[model samples]
Target: MIEMINIGLPDAIAYRIEGKITEKEMKTVLAIFRKKIKKNEKLIIYQEVVSIGGVEFNAMIEKWKFFLAFGLSHFSRIAVVTHKKWIHKLVDLEGKLFKSIEMRGFSKEEKDQAIEFLS
Candidate 1:
């Protein structure tokens, strides 16, 4: 599941993900991303990934591609809050691939810092 939290900032879009992430959730996120991109060429994304156990591999692959394509071009920065070490490492490696956007991984306790970074 994916839930959006509006911060009332033109460049800020925050989301929390839990349980399984279906195609529907991906589509919803993509729709919001499109709207944000239309409004501002560059934005900031704050994502909290709580769990990935219920998510399917294929779905994740597709969603990852979509994120890389759209997010790389439209977002200036991405702050990911996760307790999972693997996710942190993965995001760190992926961040190296994007030139325009910088990605940072933070622990759950660093949520405030993450938000500040996006702001």
Candidate 2:
């Protein structure tokens, strides 16, 4: 399941993710991103990952399509808070690949730090 988080920012949004992510949920998130883009909002994302069972294949396709269509310029920063060390490492690698967006991973304990980084 995916739950939106309110971090009190107009251009920025946050979400908590747990369990498997479905195609329906992915579409919902894409809709939100499209709305932000249409509004000309420079976006920042903060994701708190409690647990991830997996992502549906269709959801992955949808995510890739969104990125391809919109590109990454609309995003300014992405902060991922998770307990998994592997996820942090992956985020680090992703940061290297996606140079335009500042992506950082924080442990659950450092969620405040993630928000601060976003700010």
Candidate 3:
């Protein structure tokens, strides 16, 4: 499941992932995000991972499409908080794709640090 995190910030986008993510949910959220974020606007993205059951094939394709069409450069900062090793590595690898963005992975215990880093 994918749940958007609300920190009550206008320029920040955060999501919590529990189980497998579906394409419909992603498209809905992506639409909302795209509408809220203006072109070339700096955005701070947060992914708080509780547990990832994996992503549906269509969902993965949607993600790729979003990145290809919009690009990750719109996000000036991206922070992910997770205890899972694979998730940590995954974020690190994804971060490499956006060298212009300041991306960091924090343990679940360091979620506060992640938020502060984004701030």
Candidate 4:
């Protein structure tokens, strides 16, 4: 499941992910992102992924493609909070593939720092 917390800022979109992420959840997130992109020239995304166990591999692959299609044109910054070290390494290594977006991964303890960076 994904829960969105609107920070009431034009430049920020915060989301907390738990349990399983379905196609519906991905659609909702993408919809909100599209709207935010239209309204703001640049957006900062703060995503906290608590667990990846509940997510299906196929669903994740589909979501990955969706994000790849979306690209980095709309967002300026992306802060990801995850406990998985492999995820952090992946983000660090592949983040350069995105042109405009600056992606950063953080541990749970660095959540505050991530938020601060995005803000």
Root-mean-square deviation of candidate 1: 2.7
Q: Could you tell me how far off, in angstroms, the CA of residue 62 lies in candidate 3 after the best superposition? A: 1.6
Q: Candidate 2, residues 1-119: lDDT per residue as tens digits?
A: 89888976556788899999999999998899999899998789999899999999999999999999999899999999999999999999999998998999999999889988988
Question: Per-residue alpha-carbon lDDT of model 3 for 1-119, expressed as tens digits?
Answer: 98987855667888898988999878977876677565656778888889878888999888889888887656788899988888778778877876898888999889888888887
The sequence of per-residue lDDT tens digits that candidate 4 reaches over residues 6-117 is 6445577789888888777777877777787777667789888887648666667767886787666777888889998987998787677775678999999998888888
**Winning candidate number (lDDT):** 2
Q: In candidate 2, which residue pairs get closer than 3 Å at backbone N, Cα or C atoms, i.e. clash?
A: none
**lDDT for model 4:** 0.80
Question: Scored by Cα lDDT, where does model 2 land?
Answer: 0.92
Report the error of model 2 at residue 5, Å: 1.5
Residue 16 deviation, candidate 1, in Å?
A: 1.0
Better of 2 and 4 by TM-score: 2
lDDT of 1 by residue, 3-107 (tens): 887645557778888988777777777777788787776768889999864866666776787778765677788999999999999889889977578899999
Q: How accurate is candidate 3 locally (lDDT)?
A: 0.82
Candidate 2 stretches greater than 4 Å from native: none
Q: Give RMSD to native, each candidate.
A: 2.7, 1.1, 1.9, 2.7
Q: Clashes in each model (backbone N, CA, C under 3 Å)? A: 0, 0, 1, 0
Local accuracy by lDDT, each model = 0.81, 0.92, 0.82, 0.80
Show model 4 residue runs off by greater than 4 Å: 6-10, 54-70
